[model samples]
Target: MKKYLLLSAFATLTLLSCNNEGTSVNNTVESMKTPAMENFDKAFKSLGDPQNRPTEEEKKRNTSELSDRRKALLVPASKELILSLGVTESELMRKTGGDMSQIIVWATQIYMKKSDEIRKNIKSEK
Candidate 1:
């Protein structure tokens, strides 16, 4: 009876430890967002603001075009995100031709690539 009790206690401890390990890994991934990732997330999320969203008329007018006002809203955050990724102002201008949309797109691509690399590293570590 004592041996059976000891085995049950050991099994409980082993299961608890395994559960804690999974939670810790999830916590690590959640905490691993770099500043650049934060900035990129912020820049994209800005468009979800009511003031930033295009009205029906505006959308009908030109679905492909972002108005100057909308561009104004995105430019600062987008520039910050791009610069955080080690891109110089001159290099950004040369690469994006001073287009706010292009800057955002380029930054998003970089963000996705970096995110993929992080995920790959985490998977490999496990």
Candidate 2:
């Protein structure tokens, strides 16, 4: 009787866990169809136009917030990292931080990849 009770309890927990996971899987599938990429492309193109380049004030702020030397060091490394992640030049630039677009891009890729990996693992388990 004790063995039967333990098995039933284990089965109950497993079913409840799967039930909760069903909602998350459904939500992820729904979100995958959202028009987020369109919005991102629109915003990215706007940021790339020459006439829309950062203003003098913005440059000054960036320079002050982040020294020129650090910015120079990060920019190329950031660009390479973003490229590796398949992000476009315009998209990478749009995610700038003070003067550190490269670092920002790298960090963004890291986070996004991490989230994707986690989601993949969850799906695999399911």
Candidate 3:
């Protein structure tokens, strides 16, 4: 009976330690957002707003085409997000020829790649 009690106590302690470690890892991952990640998240979420979403007519029209005015609305946010990712304005302009669509696309790709790296790091740590 003494041996049984000692074994039970050890098992309980081991399970508790494991649960705490998993919680700590989860909290660490949740708090690992960079400024660039936040900027990209905010920029993408802005598109979900009612005013930013395309209207039915717009959907029926050239759905892929963004009017200059619409592009202008997103340009500042896109620039901020891209710049946060360590690209200089001059380099961005040179690479994209000052095109808003190219800038947004490049920023999105960078954000996705960064996110992938973070996920891989978390998995490796686990």
Candidate 4:
């Protein structure tokens, strides 16, 4: 009888532990989502959608707009790096107009690659 009781108790604890783990897994999944991540996902999805594709005529106009958007997002903080490097941000913008081609044409120009810490933070989100 004692052995039977012990076996039953062990089974009960095992079942309880497994139940707790399932709850934790559900919580983990729920916690994984954030507004920024949702926006990022949506942005990529829209980019991939066939309806969003641009024509050759739209390329120049769209390129300028995209460049402005990127500069607006990044140039504010990048000013210090730009100034310290002794490069004129305005002229750079005027010349490249936000195109990545500057890096290829002027191989010596400063290029900012994403840092490892940034990569880690982005990776951790998912």
> Using Cα atoms with residue i matched to residue i, what is each candidate's TM-score against the true structure?
0.69, 0.29, 0.67, 0.29
Cα deviation of 25, candidate 1, in Å: 5.2
User: Model 3, range 1-126, lDDT digits (tens) per residue?
Assistant: 999999999999999999998898767655676776676677667777888887777777875777555676667767877788678989989999999888778877877787788778898976
As for TM-score, the candidate ahead, 2 or 3, is: 3
Give the per-residue lDDT digits (tens) of candidate 4, residues 1-126: 999999999999999999997787556543553433333334434544565555456675755443433333334334334344456868657766755434223321332132333445555865
lDDT, candidate 1, 6-94, per-residue tens: 99999999999999999987777657877767766776688789977987777888768777677777677778777886889999999
Candidate order by lDDT, decreasing, is 1, 3, 2, 4
> In candidate 1, residue 49 scores what lDDT?
90
lDDT of 2 by residue, 1-126 (tens): 999999999999999999998888867754553243323324345555575556676776765443444345445544554555677777766666434654645654654665577578667877
Which has the greatest TM-score? 1
lDDT of 3 at 116: 82
Error of 4 at 47 (Å): 29
Clashing pairs in 2: 78-102
Task: Give the 10-residue window scoring lowest on summed lDDT in candidate 1.
Answer: 35-44
Q: How well does model 4 score by local distance difference test?
A: 0.49
Candidate 4 backbone collisions, by pair: none
- What's the CA error at residue 70 for candidate 2, in Å? 1.9
Error of 1 at 35 (Å): 1.5
Q: Between 1 and 3, whose TM-score is larger?
A: 1
Clashing pairs in 1: none
